[model samples]
Target: MQNGTVSMAELLNSSSALIFMGTGCSSAVPNAMCLIQPSDPPCSVCSQSLSIPPDLNPNYRGNTSLLIDHLQSNGEHSYILIDVGKTFREAALRWFTFHKIPRVDSVILTHEHADAVLGLDDIRAVQPFSPTNDISPTPIYLTEDSMNSVGVKFPYLVQKKLKEGQEVRRVSQLDWRIIESHHEKPFVASGLQFFPLPVMHGEDYVSLGFLFGETSKVAYISDISRFIPSTLSVISKSGGGQLDLLIIDTLYKTGSHNTHFCFPQTLDAVKTICPKRALLVGMTHEFDHHKDNEFLTEWSKREGIPVQLARDGLRVPIDL
Candidate 1:
C-alpha cells in the first residue's frame, strides 16, 4: 500500500484543494445523499469537505451535472472552477447556493467546446456588491486558440470598440485574463500553475486538461479523447507523487470509444498515474450510481487503490 503518512507544513501555509467529482455531461442530475453521514447534530458526513450548492432558478436540464471545484487556502482562500460546461448557469447557482465560496477570483478555460465553456457569463453572480452595483469582471485565463474560439462564441466580450479617451479597457470592465499558450504550454495565471495536457478529440484541436496549485496539486482532465505520449510525460514529470487527487473523464463503459476513455482505459490511466485517490467523472444515465458504487467498492478492494464513483453533489478534499 502507498505510504499513509501525511505531511505537515511549517506556519501552516494557507493551502487547500477541493475536487467536485460529479458528472458534467448532458444528463439530468441525480440527487445524492451522504453515504457516510452520522446520526447527530453538526453531522460529519452531512458537512463533508464538499457541499452541494442550492438550486436557484431550478431550471437546469441538459447533461449530467458533474462540477469540479479545485480550491487553495494558504493566505486567502482561492477557488478555481474548470470546464464550465453547457450547464454553467445551473452549476454556478448550485455552487453559490451550497458553499460559502468567497469569490470566483479567476476562471481557466479548458477548451472552446460548448460543453466546456458555455458558462462564461455565469460570473455575473459574483460582481461587486450593489443593488445595481457594477461589479468588477473576474479574470479568465485561456490560450490564444481558445481565446479566438471565445471571441467567436462571445463576440461582445473580445470585440474591440472605439470609445473616446479609451484605447484600452479598464480591468474592472472586462472579466478576462489572456493566457499566451497552445496545448501543452506551461501557463501560470492568478497564482495558479496550469499545464495544459495535450489531448486528442477526434482530430479536433479542442479540449485540454489542467494541473493546478503549487506545493500540493490537483489534476483535471475532462472531455479528453486520448492522452497522448507527450502529455503523459508532462503529467508524470509535473505530478511528482505530490498529487492528492486526479479527476478524469470516463464517459463510456467497457466498450471501445474512439474519442473518450472507456472504463478499462480509465483503469489503465489510474494504474499509470497512481494518484493517492482516483475519481471517475462525466457519468451518465447508463452508469447508475447504485450499480457503480457496488462495482467500485469491489474494484477498489481487489485493486488495492482508492477509487470512487463521482456523483452530482460529492466533494473530495485535498489538504495537507
Candidate 2:
C-alpha cells in the first residue's frame, strides 16, 4: 500500500478508516457514450453534451466503484461495497488491480436493480485462494425487499440440492439480513453497522441507501426521487455534524428530474450533508467529465465544499 498505511489485515485491526477505490458512473461506460460522437449527426454541442470522459481519452469507464475501509484496533477491518452493477466483474478486476485488495470480506446490496446487483457472481473470482474463515459464504447483506428480489432473479443460489453438501458451495451461502422499514435506524450485520435510509425509486419498488461504519462513517444514497424529511432526520442522526464522505446520485443536470436528483438539487443536498468531501456517483451520459468539473469547481467554491466528479478507475484516498 501507500506509505504509513496499514495492510488490509492490519487496518482491520485498527479503527477509524475509509477507502474509495473507484468512482465511475453506474454503467462502467467506456471513455465516452457509445452513441453520438463529436462528428455525428445533429451538431457538435449535442454530441459533446452526451460524453463523460470527452472524446480525447480512450480508456474511461462509466459506473462507480466503492470500498468502505473499517478497521478499529485489532478488529476485522473489512470492506462494504455499496453497489455491484452489471459491470461489477470488470469493476472488481479493475479495483483489485488498482488497490491491490486481495479479498472483499462482504458486500452490501443497495437495491435489486441490474446496475446494482447484476455482478453478484463476480465474487467467485476473488474467493480466498485457501478459503479463509472456514469456507463460509462471502456474506452479502441486503434489505428485505432486495433479498427477496435477488432470490427471485438469481435463484440458482438457493435452488434445490442436486448433490449432498453441494448446496454449501453455491456462491457460498447467501446470508440474509432483514432490514427494518423505519429507514432511519442503524443496524449491524456481519461486523459493521449500517444506517439505512428509505428512498423512492420510480413508484415501482422501495430502494435503500446506506451509511456503513467499520470505524468511520460514509453515507451512500443515490437513485432516489427526493430526500424527504425522514431521510434528512436520518442524515442528521447518523451523520451527526457531518460525514467523512457522501456518495450521492446526480442523474440529471440542472433541471428537475421526476425520479432522480438534478445537479442543482444534488448540490443542495451536498450542502446539507456537509461532508469533508462529496463525490457524485450514478451519473448518466448527460455529464461530460472535463466540462462538468468546470461547473462543479465553481459550485464547490461558492458552497465551500470539495466535490469530485467521478470517472472510471479514479482512486481517491479516504483519509484514515
Candidate 3:
C-alpha cells in the first residue's frame, strides 16, 4: 500500500483526484492585454509576473475542473470529469493531451454557469478515441434546472429533431441524466458513488458540492458562496465527522463575492469541515503561485491545518 504523499504521475496512474484547472472566475491568469503592457499604476501580480518569461515564472491558469480517475481491475481506466468550462480545451491541450487521457467516462456538473458548462461542446474531440465501435455517448449528471439550461444553451445537441433537410453536424456526444440535489441520495458514476452536498451559491442560486469514497471521504466544492447548516451537518457526519481532503473555492483573497467564495469564506468553510488536508481552488490573477504558497505555508502552520493553493496540474491521491 502507498504511504505518505504521492506524486502527480503516481496519482494519475492509479485511482486519484486531479485538479485539471484551478482558476475560479471566468478569465484565466496572465491576461493578454496585461502581457502587452503593464497596468496604469502597475498591477502587482500581473505586471511583475509578465515581465518575466512564461517558462521562468509560469503563473498562467485555467478554469476550475477536477478529474476523478478509477483504475479497473482489468487494467483499464475510467475518468469522471467535473465541470467542463470554457477553458476546458486549453487545459486539455496543456495537461490531458500529454497524459494520454483520451476518453472521458462521465461528467458531473455543479451548476449551469458559463464557467461551469461552456466547454460541453469540446467533448466531441474525444469521440474518435471511444473504445466502443458504436461510439456510445458519455453520460452527464446534473440537476434538472441545470439540464434545462444546458438544453437552452446547446439546442442543436439537446434536440433530437433538427431543421427539415438540414444535415446533421458532428457535435458533442453526451447523454443527460438529471440528478436530484437533495443531499440525501447518492449516485454512482464511473464505478464510484458520489454523495451530493447541496450549498448556496448566493442569495438566489444553489450549487452542489460532492462527497465521495468509503474509507477516506474527499469533499469537493469548486464554487460556493456559503453553506447551509443542513449541508454542514451532512459533511460533518461524513468520513467519521471529518473530511480526508477538502477542495474548496477561493475566488479571491479579499472582497465579498455574490456567487463565489473569497478567502475568508473559504477559511470559514474549512474550519467547519475540519478536513485533514485542504486545497484552495477557483483562484484569480490576484493569487501568485510562489507568493501564495509562502502565505499558505505560514497560515497552515498557524492554523495547524495543512492547506495550500491548488494549481492547474495538481494531482492528489485519495487513500481508500
Candidate 4:
C-alpha cells in the first residue's frame, strides 16, 4: 500500500472503528470566546489547556462524524460517512486528505440540523476522484423529513439546477434515498448494512442512530437526548445484549439540555446498553481532555466497562 492510501484490505482486516470527528453540540471544542486570558480566572477545562495552545491541542475536536470502510466483493473500497457538518471541510482537509480517502460512497444523515447537513456542498471535492463511474450520482440515505429539509436548504444540489444567471460552481451531485426507521429491516450501502435506530432529540424532535456490522456490531448515536425503548432493544440484539462499541453523545459534563445528553444521562445510557467499550462524542468547551480522561478512567474501572473520549483522527479497528 502507498504511504497515505487506505486499502480495502487494511480496513476489512481491522477490528476497530475510526472516529473522524468527536464532539457534542455544534460549537465544538476550544470555543473562541471561551478561551481564557492570563489575567482571567481559571476556567476549569479551557483554562488548564491554554499552556499548549488551542491549535496544538490534540484534544480540540470538530463536529461529530464517523467513517466506516468496507471492502466490496469486487475488491473495491467503500467509504461511508455519517453526518457531514459545518466543520467537515476543515476536518477533511486536516485528516482525510492526508489519508488519501478517495471518495464517499454514501452518506447517512442523522437529522437536518445545520450542524449536521451544512457541508453538503463540500461533496463536490470528492467527485473528481470517485471510483464509481455509473450514471447515478452519489447516494445519500436519509429520512423523509431530513430529505425535505436538505432540499429546502440546498436546492441547487437536490434539484440539480442553478438559478437564472447564477455563477456556475461545482455542487454536490447526490441521489437522495429515503430510509425507513426500522431496525429489523436494514438498508445496505456499499456491501455494508445499516440498521437505523431511532432516538429522541427532545420533546419536539427525533433523530436516528445507526447500527453497523453483523457479528460484532458498532452503534453510533451522535446527537440524542434519549433513546427509544425499541431502539435500545435493537441495539441489544445487535450484539446479543452487549455491543462491541457504543459511540454516544456526551454534550456536556454537567447542567441540563433539552436536546442533548449530559454526562449523567450519557453514563446512564452507556450502563444500560452495557457495551464492551464506549467512546463519548459531541462534546463542548467544558470538557477538558486531561481532566475528562482522568475521570473516565476511574469511572470505567468502577463500572467494569471500558470507556473513553473520542478525539479527531482517532482510529479503531472494527473487528467483525
Evaluate model 4: give its lDDT. 0.78
Candidate 3 off by > 4 Å: 1-12, 47-58, 73-75, 129-134, 237-240
lDDT of 4 by residue, 1-320 (tens): 68998887575444434646545458766665667353356555555456765345756777888877665556566788899998888887776765556678888899999889998898777676333332357789999999999889988777765578866555677889999877876899777888899899997899999988776778999889888889988676354477888999988789778998989899988888889899988888778777788999999999998998877777676643
Model 2 CA deviation exceeding 4 Å by range: 1-28, 31-59, 129-134, 163-173, 214-216, 236-239
Residue-level lDDT of model 2, residues 1-320, one tens digit each, is 57977787454334443444444445544434444344335333234435633323312543455666555345545666766777767666655665556677778776788877877766666775433224556677777778878889878764535576553443534455666645556776545778787777665566788866533557788677776567776565244556777778877676877667778888888887788778887666566667888888998899888896665555454434
Model 3 C-alpha lDDT per residue in residues 203-310, reported as the tens digit of each score: 788999998878687888888888877778777635348877888998888987998899988887777678888988888878887888899899889887889887
Best model per TM-score? 3
How far residue 100's Cα lies from its native spot in candidate 1, in Å, is 1.2
In order, candidate lDDTs are: 0.59, 0.64, 0.78, 0.78
For every candidate in turn, the CA RMSD to the true structure comes to: 9.2, 5.1, 3.9, 4.2
lDDT of 1: 0.59
Error of 1 at 31 (Å): 14
| Residue 286 CA displacement from its true place in model 4, Å | 1.0
TM-score of each model, paired residue for residue: 0.73, 0.78, 0.88, 0.86
Kindly give the stretch of ten consecutive residues in candidate 4 with the minimal lDDT sum. Answer: 127-136
Poorest stretch of ten by lDDT in candidate 1: 56-65
Q: Tens digit of lDDT per residue, candidate 1, span 119-225?
A: 66555555565443245666777767888888888775665464676444322234666664334467655556687776776565556777765655667777667
Candidate 2 matches the true fold with a TM-score of: 0.78
